[model samples]
Target: MGRTASVLLRVLGMLWTAPNTGLGLIAGSVGLPFGARVHFDPHTVALVFHRWPWGPGGAMTLGNTILHTGETLDAPCLTYAHRAGHCEEPPVRIGDHERAHVYQYMALGPLFLPLYLVCGGISVRNRFERAADRYAQTGRGWWPW
Candidate 1:
């Protein structure tokens, strides 16, 4: 039960619980191509580690990596922050709050730092989804406000 092994098990467990294809019927609903692959499933909690070649520190924590991805709209992200030396726990998701932060961060940039601080406290997944849908449909630039 080493750290790497534990992380692998966690990832495997998460993937095992997910639909075999990892693609869903709702892909088109989000304006993604019909067969576009999803990076993560909402049904299960998994450890997503950012590709940190630098290794440790530099916002390498799970929360920071997840927040960074949300802030930058970077997909296919990962993090190694949840490691606990052979007994790593599943990473906690910012969920709707993270989603909302992502939307605002993409739309507003650094100017909306104050609001971004509060985004994690809000529950507005529907609004964020709608905003994302609009962004995908028109390819218009987003505003963080």
Candidate 2:
């Protein structure tokens, strides 16, 4: 794709996912008073909130916002990074997995959460989550479908 087309697609994806992103932003806002730090990542075109102080003690991706209780992973993707907890295979980098969710959210838009629940929410059986893991491991296949 040409640069213009790529840019346009990115913009379109952002627009399509705006509603969920807004919700994510609202959720992230609650973390601000608790010392959550926020930063804009131009590479992924998303907002990341680290040290969010909530959730199941890990990272969560909602649209373009990612909330995490731990620090961002910068080292090589580790064997224990996958959320499914199956260590026989390689692990999925949390950053990559969450970023893949952002991409998935762009494609699914408001349908993301509904479909995610239908796919078993956050379990290993959830196709959305499995796809995110696939994306993290291979750099592709973020789409649940």
Candidate 3:
């Protein structure tokens, strides 16, 4: 895909996930300021630093933190601290996966949430999650699933 289209998808992702994005921004500004450093990539998605020690601990939480609302948050931003004493994978790989989720947001818009819930299962069975995994492995500029 062209850069313009990629950017447009990201913008649409932001708008589609606005409610969660707003909560993430608010959380970052309020409680997360000292807890984590926020990083916004060229894709315009926000990544928050979340040390595993301070909050909940899990491998799933290591990348895009899935909230109670069932939203896998990669848009807007949230800190993702590596587990203490464990070396997480390089940011490039993680970013690729997360970026794919951002694209999913763009494609599904408001429908993403409910659909994600209905399709809830292991990543392998979930079409959205599978597409994201594919994107991470393949790189950018492909059609959104």
Q: Rank the candidates by TM-score, best first.
A: 2, 3, 1
- Regions of model 1 farther than 4 Å from truth: 1-109, 119-129
For candidate 2, write residues 43-66 as lDDT tens digits. Answer: 566898888988777677788888
lDDT against true structure, model 3: 0.47
Candidate that would win on lDDT = 2
Higher-TM-score candidate of 1 and 2: 2
Best by TM-score: 2
Give the TM-score (vs. native) of candidate 3. Answer: 0.57
**Per-candidate clashes, comma-separated:** 11, 0, 9
Candidate 2 residue-pair clash tally: 0
Q: What's the candidate order when arranged by decreasing lDDT?
A: 2, 3, 1
User: For model 3, how does the per-residue alpha-carbon lDDT over 1-145 read when each residue is reduced to its tens digit?
Assistant: 9999977866776677776555455554453445444544454255544432233432121112222211223322221222222334333354455666655655565666677768864334566655654565567542434
lDDT score, residue 49, model 3?
A: 40
Per-residue lDDT for 139 in model 3? 78
For residue 60, model 2's alpha carbon misses the true position, in angstroms, by 1.1
